[model samples]
Target: MTTEPSQLKFILSSVLLITCGQFHYTFLFRAI
Candidate 1:
């Protein structure tokens, strides 16, 4: 049970990081 929640959290964080990275890249490209 606890392990499942931990796994889910890890997956969520990875997804958030990827999305934020993509967003930042686009913003930087636009600024250039």
Candidate 2:
């Protein structure tokens, strides 16, 4: 049960990282 929760957290973090990366790129493009 603990392992399942950890796995879910890892997946959620990865999705968040990707989304943040995309947003960062867009912001940079707009700044340029």
- In candidate 2, which residue ranges exceed 4 Å CA deviation? 1-3
The ten-residue window of minimal lDDT in model 2 covers: 1-10
Candidate 1 global CA lDDT score? 0.95
* Model 2 accuracy (lDDT, Cα): 0.95
Clashing pairs in 2: none
Give the lDDT of residue 3 in candidate 1.
Answer: 66
lDDT of 1 at 10: 94
Candidate 1 lDDT over 1-32, as tens digits, reads 35688899999999999999999999999999
TM-score of each: 0.88, 0.86
**Worst 10 contiguous positions by lDDT, candidate 1:** 1-10
